[model samples]
Target: MQTRNRVAMSRRAFAGSLGALVLCAPAVARAQSSGVVRRNTSGFKLHNWQDHFDELGKGIIISDTNSRVMQQWMPGGEMFIYPTSVPMTDELTRRGYTEITFKDPAPDWTPTPSMRERDPSLPAYMPPGPDNPLGARAMHLSWQYYRIHGTHDTRKIGRRSSSGCIGLYNEHIIEVYDRTPVGTQVKLI
Candidate 1:
């Protein structure tokens, strides 16, 4: 009789667990469909240079805000892609054509007027160092106060966290800064 009771209890426990799974299946499916579930590193979409550029003039750099990825295409069909941190909001984003006006290997930081307006406590200027927000390198764009630079804060990558600049990892920015020259065509979309 004890053996029969034990078997019955085991079957009851299994049935309860199966029923709970069935009840939760719809919610789990809904969460996945709604994008609550995400995979790391596979979210970026590869883009064709021809689709966005007339030609790779001085090579081209494309920063896609939606995917949080940046692509660099060299003249000889060489291409490199890096995850980036985009502007925090649509209002802060500046899209369309621009070019690299300058490249700074050891960049200083000066908060823009708007940046200062947003945060009054920001310093008037910052010298280059690990603590500087521009990290190890910076590529200035034609647009005022905009840049493609590195961040000491690695958590910012693959997220919408920047004020207006496109941000990369420190090591990645060093590589990009070395490869990209002044006057390289750029587009943020």
Candidate 2:
């Protein structure tokens, strides 16, 4: 009788565990299918271009600092998303509307005044190269000292590591630079 009771308890525990797993299966499947799991560990959600743009004049770029993701919408309504490195802190972040003033295929780097003040050892100027912080390309924004640019340190992508700019992987920035044009509207949020 004792052995039979032990077996019944074990079976009940197994059934309960199995039931719990079955209940959780749909949520896991849904998250994976919806791209909330595989794309980013930061819980980044895809954005709709219409939410941030009045019209797709030229094109639009929206960088979400919270999610560390940049979403681009082309004139014809196609969209692309890329992971990004955002400002390291809220104080370093600049929000609101801006436009791409120009593009540099081989962008140079110059630490901003505040950046220099914070880190006096930083070089005053760096010419474009593999060693340059601005990796392969850069899209200058209307705001001075701000850019949506590539970084040599690929680890910075999908993290809060930039001083004030949005940083992308070198390959990703090259693609973005090719797709985006001067005067493309951008919003940082």
Candidate 3:
């Protein structure tokens, strides 16, 4: 019994030491995204890169496939690195896009026209409803064209699959939307 305890203790010590070593590695302190910056997060995810901080003010530049070039704030250096992009650029503009316009007010993401069009078989959007995809609010970047918004589907949070809009968990997106406006520049490169 005593020997087994010692083995367990040793394993824990080794894991702690290895974690410390990884955090202290040169990989953490330096910029890996060309001119883009990197910051670590404490959110519980197994991947190191997925631990990147969230800085919505920091805009993101994405590849054609919706893959991102790390993340940075608009007009500033504050940023974080996320592994995914909303609707990802390619997916966003892939089809059914009209000229950009400013929606008079935010629309419900659940039963809205765009939502129905995207998924005819899916349920509808009703404001302040629990399943509302728009969560609390969505920053209307291009009228109905695109947005950065809150989501009820938290499981989809860091993945590349989205309509053509960026998805943030309800809390995070609401915080961002409150600060954004109709003319805000959303550059999906």
Clashes of each: 0, 0, 9
Error of 1 at 50 (Å): 0.3
Return the number of clashes found in candidate 1: 0
Instruction: Sort the predicted structures by lDDT, highest score first.
Output: 1, 2, 3
lDDT of each: 0.88, 0.86, 0.49
Residue 63 lDDT (model 1):
94
The reply for model 1, stretches above 4 Å from the true place, is 1-41
For all the candidates, what are their Cα RMSDs to the real structure? 9.4, 7.6, 9.2
Runs in model 3 deviating more than 4 A are 1-9, 16-65, 68-77, 80-85, 88-107, 110-118
Alpha-carbon error at 152 in model 1, in Å? Answer: 0.5
lDDT of 3 at 155: 73
Candidate 2 residue-wise lDDT at 64? 93
Candidate 3 clashes between residue pairs 3 or more apart in a chain or in different chains? 58-72, 58-73, 59-72, 59-73, 92-164, 110-124, 110-125, 111-124, 111-125
The window of 10 residues in a row where model 1 has the poorest summed lDDT is 32-41
**Tens-digit lDDT track of model 1 for 1-189:** 355434445888999989999787744543433322222336787788899888987899999999998988888777777889999999999999999999998999999999999999999999999899999999999999999999999999999899999999998899889989899999899
Better of 1 and 3 by TM-score: 1
